[model samples]
Target: MCATLVGGMDRLKREYINAAKANGVELKVFTGKENCISEKMGQTELVIVFTNKVSHAARKEVMHYAKSRNIPVRLVHNCGVSSLRQNLATN
Candidate 1:
């Protein structure tokens, strides 16, 4: 499965990707500081937003884009690797 992660610590980006990969997910991560995130995030099956770490504008933009495309969006308040892994495991 493929997923796009919005927000979370930039330093832990590698760890996040690794964790997702371990669970058979191809993860693309955006640290919420990039410009035009919606455009940059290519085709993805799931959109995971770290609500606590992401800017309101970025979150809104991602959510809007995901909704329009009919993609599943998961909002996680805790921006931890474990939290992400847990969510992915369920799906």
Candidate 2:
């Protein structure tokens, strides 16, 4: 599975990455304004996006990329560790 932290969302990106790794999962954090999401997803089996700003475009881009790749994606709205567990469990 592939995981990328969407946006800077620095507030929680670090913790998210930490938790993901703790579960033996590797992840990439996207801190740029507009990143090459599609390309990033290419190397990943699944794209786990964590963000507070859930815009229509963001939602579309994420869903489109994951769906197109036939890779399952789980959205983490908060930095709560529980969400990470649930997300990783599916993988």
- Superposed Cα deviation of residue 24, candidate 1 (Å): 0.4
Query: Which candidate's TM-score is highest?
Result: 1
What local lDDT does model 1 show for residue 8? 99
Reference-based lDDT, residue 73, model 1 = 96
Count clashing residue pairs per candidate.
Answer: 0, 1
Regions more than 4 Å wrong, model 2? 50-52, 76-79
Give the alpha carbon lDDT tens digit for every residue of 1-91 in model 1: 8999999999999999999999999999999989899999899999999999999999999999999999999999999999999989999
- lDDT per residue for candidate 2 within 17-49, as digits (tens), equals 888888788877664356555676556766666
The TM-score that candidate 2 achieves is: 0.70
